[model samples]
Target chain A: MLSCKEAAALVSESLDRKLPLGQRIALRMHLLFCRFCRRFSRQVLFLRGTADRVRGEKEGEEPPVSDSLSAEAKEKIEQALKTHSESKSKP
Target chain B: MSIIDPSKGKGETLNPENWGKDYADYLFRYALVRLRDRQGAEDVVQETFLAALKGKDQFKGLSSERTWLVGILKHKMMDYFRKPSRELPVSGLITSEDPPEEFFDLNGKWQVKPSSWGDSPMDALEKKEFWKTFEACMSVLPGRLAQIFALREFEGLKNEEICNLFNVSTTNLNVMLFRSRMRLARCLETNWFGKKAKGE
Candidate 1:
């Protein structure tokens, strides 16, 4: 059975699928027999999934979006850019 | 999403609008993720374009065009984030646990399983309520953790990219990423399994 430290380390590598075959086999064998390790593993897997889901899920399943800027903000930047260019060209 | 490109350089040779769709959107999304605002994304886009134009003569045959453009975007973002005025917020531990013990019980035993629950995980994931529960648990996450988790896991950006964007050292980034994964596991246990514990 994998020790707690070994099991914990595998949790993140499992996220990336980077564990080597031998270690993976060891981890899997340990997970098969250990109830507590099994729950810990399940939680880690869930976290990765939730992070992705929260990022992409829309109220309508449209898509998770990082907030977009409003039109007014875009216009403000444009005006600032114009002013910046004007000053640069003058001097 | 509707495509966006500034009209200022219309019909002109030196313009990002003239770039391919994928490249433009990649930079735009990257900027959007970092700045967390649209107008800032646009200005970053503009700055990237202008920088690319000014350095157009330096485009050696070495790197691909898209890669070069991304490099400019990186510089723009780094400059923006590195500005002295704003502090970069990092995540803090809540309901802290001492190392080694927090991770493992007194007898050096795991607190929970590493693999799965009695039910299918994919099923739990598909439910809207499950996500809601997860999000509520997550929203209270420290601002620093939210960013690291979003970039590393959600955005699928590399650790190196995160290190570069946040100006965090590799060890610092690794620790942050570790804490993030650990914190998420703890939250999931509380959100999904703690009820079962009460029943038992």
Candidate 2:
């Protein structure tokens, strides 16, 4: 018999697809009889999808092209490229 | 829209410039899932690609190119989560002193019976708004608890790994994890599950 507390912890893991096989079955049976467990499971799935949507929206917004990288990073890239090209030409 | 990897010498071009939309789309979604913030996640993803381009030598192919990019994204997220306020203290999680094993029985029965719900479980969670509300709730958690929950739950890292990553003792980890789960459950209960007590 699982307690409400323990059952709740498994709910998130189950949705994430990480629960063990036996525990998965146990959870399924438990949810069959438990309203709270069922609600929690639904909520977790809902949360994953919603977060995904907001995530998509974020990536769609971007900083200007040239301004994206820092002055230091730009210099480092040039240095790496120069050294790599130079190294390839070594006899 | 170009995804250029200047350090990329002689391999298939993952240059976002050529596959800019696809690359950016993929990286953006990956970071967004973890950060739950659109602009912040995008910034991290962009930084990740730039960093990857610079340190292309660091990759030895233990994982796929995508996974490698995600690994870099994780480090970026670490910085985002490590706020100065995270230096604040957290109160105790459990005064009950119950062992984790107590949550599970030798015969594998739940300590508390689960309550039956209306129709299908999917029906309850089918709405996008439910998740929006849930994410909103999670974003407000105390910084330390949030880290512990994300690492252990989403990343699926082991207890030992979490200890090493966060430098906390096992007892401390247990308390933190227990607290994280409880607070998250409470949040979900309020935001998505409605305040109605079970079987009331």
Candidate 3:
């Protein structure tokens, strides 16, 4: 009998790869009786769904958070580019 | 957009001088979301620009400059994550105490059973406000967990690829992924779904 801990681990693994038939059956049996684990299995799927959506959005569409790279960092990057380009241009 | 005659090359130009002003934020945001480290993100974005400059001659203009730069940035970010120096910290992830213990008891039963989150997880996902909560959850995730999660889910790397990159066994990799998903699921439930359930 797989414990909830073991069951939940298998649930997560199911998302990453195919599970062996034996372990899959054990997990299904365990989830059959455990409402918490069932909710957990569903929520784990939910997490995956949410994660994919979060990454699927087009880049530069404006992050919900207003944070940006600091001005000093931007200045520093520009300086590095300027130095490199100048060095390349020289003999 | 003007139609280009294929015989006459498009001659898309590279203005390396204005790249910082034009694309720095775009690249930084992409890196920051995946790397989740301001310093690391800055370093990669800087590295990307420098590499682009060094290889500017290779810019055949098949793609837009911004597209070319982002392609370089993606490679840079992968290197940043896979660097040998980072192994010291990432190794710590392998040795951390089992996370399932936090949720399960000595008998391996759930300490706190997961509560009903109500219907339509998709509904919450579609809400603009949910992203704020999701970002907050991601920001608070332990650094190693966040990195693995980003590589797996955000970058959509295959499990075998990540296993090779991190040099962990399949079981170990699954454990890491499990822990991260559990943490993220719990965080979203507590912060978003659980709140909605209670009408708070």
Candidate 4:
């Protein structure tokens, strides 16, 4: 029987890649009996979905984008662009 | 006022000067979400613009300028993560330490069981405040783990690609991803789901 630790690792691994048939059955059996591992699996999946949404994967929903470049950083980037543009336009 | 007819391109013109004013925030947010560092995000955005400027003549108007610029931004992010110096040293711990111990015991059993987050946990995704907590939880992860997690969850890179990118065996990569998901799940429960359960 896969222990909860082994079960949890499989739970996470399943998200990244397809587990082999034998390990898949073992994880499924453990998840069937282990409510905690089941919840862990769901929450791990949820974390991915939530992250995708926040990264603007889902359309029509406004992501809660809280950060922005500071004024100094913006100015610096603008200056760099200006200098490059002028140098290119010259010789 | 420009070499090309800026107004003739359906407002998707390649005006490098106005790019910082127009797309800087959007591009920075895009990088920040994946990179999760303010300074790093800023640097990538700058690089993206510079590259876009250098390659403006190649713009074929096949896509919106934003989409084209975002394509360049994606490449910039990959290059940023690919740097050898940026790879964290803690990656070695994947071979040296036991990670599941954070939630599991030495007997390979769960030390702290996951609690029921109740039905419709999806509802939290719609709430703006929940994202605040989510970002907080994401930030709680160690840098390398978070980067790997972001690459998987946010960028949707396949496991094999990430393994090659990080130069880790699949086993080690899985362990790092497991640790990240476990910590994020635990943190969200403590900060968001657990709080909501108590009617907070």
Candidate 5:
């Protein structure tokens, strides 16, 4: 039987790649009796969802985004762009 | 002046005047969450616009203006990661410490079973505070690990692409990803779920 540590590693690895059939079978067997590993798997999925939301992936369903650039930052960018355009227009 | 002329392209022209109004906030937020540095994020957003302006003629209407700009911004982010000074010392992120005893016993059996999070995780997704807490946890991660995690999870880059970007072997990348997820899970469990459990 795979230990919880090994099983948890496999669970995380599964997220990034296709697990080999042997390892997949081992993980499934381990998860059958391990509540903690099961929870860990769920948590990994939740983390993925949270990260996706951060990237604005769940656009329509997610709540309004709370963070944004401050007015000062916007002004700075505008200033920089103004300089860039002026330089482009120059001889 | 109307900088973007419809006669020149199928998509609406990208007006320089409206660049900040149209994309600054969105781009800033995206960079802020990934880079976890307001000043750095601001600089990146600014550079993205400047670069966009230089290449405005190449805008072929293949994608939305926002998507094109974001592509530029993503390249800037990858550049930021590639800089030597920005690279964190990744040696001790995962292997240095002993595994937590609660998760496994000496014989490697699970000593503490993971408790159900109930519906709280899903519910928390709708709350602004959840993202705040999430960002806070993400910010505390080691820089390289956080960058890799964001590239994989948030940017949806493939494993081979990520390996090429970081110039690391696949085994190294997978190990870093596993450690990054474990760290974030533990962080949310303590900072978000634990606080919610106490009604805090």
Candidate 6:
């Protein structure tokens, strides 16, 4: 019987790669009896969903957060770009 | 928008004039979220614009201009993460003690069973404050661990690629990832879900 600790580790590892057949069966069997592990599996999936949002790659939708540049940073970038263009245009 | 006429060969015009108006805010926001530092994020955004200007002719236009700029910014962020100075203190993470035993009991059953997040994790994700809390949780992680998590989760890099970048064995990388995910999930549960459960 895979302990919850062992099962939880596999839960995370499974996200990275394919678990072997025996280990998969073991994990599944463990999860069957363990509501906690089931909740844990869901939590891991939730974490991935949140990560996708952070990456701005949520499927078929706009990003959840759309923070804009700060006004000061905007001014600084504009000034830098202006200087860059002027220098480039110079002989 | 009028300046982007492909037929006019204005596609070759890598104008810095419009970059700020068009892409600066978006890029800044992207960097700020990941870097989690206003000054560092601003610096990288500026560097990205300058680098894009220098290499603007290389913009094949296959991707959107924003996409192209984001590519530059991603690389810049990667460099920042890779810096030795940015590397977090390697006390707990680098040690052999990991995934601490307390997560399971003597018989290997859960010492602390994870609680359900209730229905619709999506609903929680949709909230703007959720990302802020998520960012806060991420910030609390050791810097390198957070960077690895960002590269995997945020940037969607393959484990193999990250292993190569960090030059650690797959085992070590997986351990790091497991720890990172566990920490973030627990933090979110405590800070976000737990608070919500209490009607906060």
Best by DockQ: 4
lDDT of 6 by residue, B34-147 (tens): 676678889999999999878877887555677788899999988877776765455634433565555667787776667778898779876889878887788898766887
Q: Give lDDT for model 1.
A: 0.60
User: Candidate 4: which pairs clash?
Assistant: none
DockQ per candidate, 2 decimals: 0.31, 0.10, 0.68, 0.69, 0.59, 0.61
Better of 1 and 3 by TM-score: 3
Note the residue pairs that clash in candidate 6: none
True contacts kept of each: 0.35, 0.04, 0.84, 0.73, 0.68, 0.76
For every model shown, what is its TM-score relative to the native structure?
0.54, 0.49, 0.87, 0.90, 0.84, 0.84
Model 1 spans with C-alpha error above 4 angstroms: A20-22, A54-91, B1-101, B111-118, B124-126, B167-172, B192-200
Give a tens-digit lDDT track for model 6, residues A1-91. 9888788889998998999999999999999998998888999999888887667653334444466778988999999999987887799
Q: What is the interface RMSD of each candidate, in Å?
A: 5.8, 9.0, 2.1, 1.6, 2.6, 2.5
Global CA lDDT computed for model 4: 0.84
Rank list by DockQ: 4, 3, 6, 5, 1, 2
- Pairs with backbone N, CA or C atoms under 3 Å apart (clashes), candidate 3: none
Q: CA lDDT of B105 in candidate 6?
A: 72
lDDT of 3 by residue, B52-159 (tens): 988887887766778799889989998997898877455467443556688889999998778888877778876888888888888898777788888898788899
lDDT of 1 by residue, B57-109 (tens): 66653544666777788688667665655345334432123243566666657
TM-score of chain A of each: 0.59, 0.58, 0.80, 0.86, 0.77, 0.76
For each candidate, give the TM-score of chain B: 0.50, 0.58, 0.85, 0.88, 0.79, 0.80
Q: lDDT, candidate 1, residue B187? A: 72
Tell me the tens digit of each residue's lDDT in model 4 across B65-161: 7889889999999998888977778634464255767688889877888998999999998788998998888788877788888899878889888
Interface RMSD of 3: 2.1
Task: For residue B44, give model 2's deviation from the true position in Å.
Answer: 4.3
Best by TM-score: 4
* Residues A37-64, model 3: lDDT tens digits: 9999999888788767756655445544
